[model samples]
Target: MEFDTPVLDNHLHLDPENGRGMEAVQDFARSGGTHLLVVNKPSWTLGIDVDEPADFRAAFETTIDIVDEASELLGGRAWPVLGVHPGLVSHLTERGFTPDEAGELMQAGLDIATEYVPSEALALKSGRPHYDISADVWDASNRVLQHALALGAENDCAVQLHTEASEDLTEIADWATERDLPAHRVVKHYAGGRLVGPMPSVMSEKDRLAEAAERGEPFLMETDFIDDPERPGAVLGPKTVPRRVRWLLDEGFDDAVRTAHVETPRRVYGIETLG
Candidate 1:
């Protein structure tokens, strides 16, 4: 199907298991996908901690190294968005890395990642979740975010942020704005704010998207809901993606919805889709 606008995918995960590594991205571009923002969320990707592995530092180091390799492989076709996930924040803290050290580690990761990943793929402040209780933790989280923003500015890439709770999105917007980046440039994901409780019925997704549009804010929609007889909440049938896309399109806000799902994300991360 032909879309009126460029179909940039704001949220895409790199599953090492897929074997495409970074090379598969080229295929996405050929299919008329304009851009892709590859996000590395440990819990979602590795099913383990970012700080895990016998070689903690190496685990972090290797992620960037692979990303850098992928960047070079995908070239302009893909961009990288790297960060320490909030769920993994506690894990990093327990390792006794100061906020400064954590920020430094992230930078090193980006440096190596970009070598393989496109320079257009940039560093992002990821992993800040709401369940974190320490006010001081926010300070650490902010430090990481600030560092990523600075790096992003230097490289001319946008930052992707994930807030644990939906209520915190406004604050996140404020932070991004303070960094001199457009609020829209601060891409968010996972329906991180959408699956609040119980089952997420279709109407819930509709209401949230409507609210975000009314406020002129970008909304995140996901196609990765995994359905399981044992764990029904995990599956996202393929039908869901086009359904949600159709909903936004039917609402007559096709441009805005398309941007959130594709264009804005591509512009921010520096990714091009391959067919």
Candidate 2:
């Protein structure tokens, strides 16, 4: 079987602490990769010594700085997707913060078109969705998402999100449709079997993808895979990645998967399209 080299890596991380850096990224690209989406987390959220308040803030700032600098330095070579991760949100709650406050802050990140979402409450209870925040929290989250949509429109940034289920994305899709926002403006990230649940339902990933296809909704393909094994989370298996792409191809939806992962993300970040 023949395969194509990626013009871009739609989702990626580069951290010195994690042992991923410029060299590693370059090698990946040289081996037929052209672009990368560098995923960064705020330093405060970095899993360093979160035992102290100072450590937390440092990690947070570091993440912000990394995004800014990488955007400038990488230029057409790499792009960025910013967000406070769901896992990090859980960690913050364990450290201390009212659920309402946590939800509010998470929305603030969303408002700016941050790349990820707080899938659920701390302790990582993702099995139980948390769309039912307090009224105030819901309003706040809505306002932020609205602002994010506007920013994404202006900057050509795609809003990368992680949801407890596909239904959680309906409102976003509706909003985009109501406003006539471009399909490529929003790229649902970490979308797969993980958050979509183990059973078929209205909220399943397949249902969501079919809906998106019918409505021309755009979505970037992301593995949401991590290095950890003990955690019941989205694991990006190298072998699985190509297989998923192949599956989409077989489904007659290869263009969506390729365009989302390659064209849309690069265009948003002002990078060259992969040939």
Candidate 3:
């Protein structure tokens, strides 16, 4: 299926050493995808033990390299979103660091990530864990999240969140407002439905996409493709976004396709073109 507007996958990770890497991207391109927000995988995924903030550089650089390669392959259709993955707190604590120490390290990592913004990277990625945790860890995570929001505001870019599933995010929205980052610029990755605060990057599920489209509000689409060979197609396949856009077109939701694939992303990421 041919699309007049750009087809974007808002959240994706590629690991050449451990996963399909460019082969997965090729599948997306073959299925009509034009643009990607290539997010940084967790530092642990790259076998990095983050004892200090500088340890994040390797993972961020790897993501940036992937973005560059993807752009070269697709003619400037990729952008890097780099930051410390929120789950790093648990990993750090498990490695003997206290919760507060973990939080401080994560914030410092985000500070380094901010240095690449509006240059090597287009946005930041950070959020609290989506699973059960102790109170101290949760508080630390929120601190990191607040810092991410402030950094996004300072850098004039978006912050893609990997957070717990919730029907409303008014608290997060309020935090963004407090930090001077526009609510729309705070994207909720892997969203299952339309959310109240941050912009929902709805997973490419037909029913959820259809429901989000029905609202006609500004939102983005994503596959959250982890690109892990061990768990192939964990969240969704890389080609899912383009294929779902095709489904939306077939269902006569042309406006939704335009909003999800082009308009919303352009506004949120501040990208001039998806091509």
Candidate 4:
């Protein structure tokens, strides 16, 4: 199948060491995907025990390299979004670091990630844990999230957030506002439906895509394909966005498909020629 407009997967991972890697990207391209925002996996997933901030460099570099290689193979573009995953907080605490210490380490890691923005990386990823946690740990996570927001503001790049499911993102929008990051640039990854605040990278589900289109709101589409060989098709597959967009186009949702797959991503990520 071919798409008239670029098909972008806003959040995807390619693990060359442990998963199908570029082969999964091939699946997306064969399904008509054009662009992607390849996000970095958690440090531990890359076998890096984050005892220090610089330890994140390997993971970030790997993501950059993947983006470079994927872009060469892709019909369109592939930009890297590097950062410290919010789950790193739990990992750090479990490794014997206190909540505050964990937060500090995460913030430092994000600081390193920012150095790559607008050049090696196109955006930064950060958020609090979606699952339950102690208040102290939650607070620490919030601090780290705020730090990421600040970095996004400073770097003039988008920030992809992975947080608990919520119908509204007013609170997070406020955080972006305080940091001077455009609310629209603060994307809520894995979003289920139309949200109240912050731009949503809606998961590529048929019903949800139709709902967002019907509302005529600007949004982006994503698969969040983890590419883990151990759990194939976890979250969603690499070809999901293109497949869903093809269906929406067949259903006469052309305008929505254009806005979600092209316009929204171009505006938010500052890519002038995405489609």
**Candidate 4 residues 1-275, lDDT tens each?**
67778888899899998998889889999999888899999998888999889999999999999999999878998999999899999999998999999999999999999999887899999999999999999999999999999999999999999999987989999999999998999999999768988899999998888888998999999988997888875789988888998899889999998898778987898784353
Please provide, for model 2 over 113-186, each residue's C-alpha lDDT reduced to its tens digit, 9 standing for 90 to 100.
32222211000001112455445444544554555555555444455444444534556656654554554445
TM-score, model 4 to reference: 0.98
Put down candidate 3 lDDT per residue, 110-196, tens digits, no spaces: 999988988899999999999999999999999999999999999999999999998699999999999999999999998976789
On the 0 to 100 scale, the lDDT of residue 2 in model 3 is 52
For model 3 the TM-score comes to 0.98
Pairs in steric clash, model 2: 42-59, 42-60, 43-59, 43-60, 44-56, 44-59, 44-60, 82-115, 111-144, 225-236
Off by over 4 Å in 3: none
Cα deviation at 45, candidate 2, in Å, is 4.8
Each candidate structure's TM-score, on Cα atoms with residue i matched to residue i, is 0.62, 0.56, 0.98, 0.98
Report the C-alpha lDDT of model 1 over 76-116, residue by residue, as the tens digit.
Answer: 44445655555455656677966655555544544443343
Name the regions of candidate 4 deviating beyond 4 angstroms: 273-275
Local lDDT at 179 for model 3: 90
Question: Lowest summed lDDT over 10 consecutive residues: which window, candidate 4?
Answer: 266-275
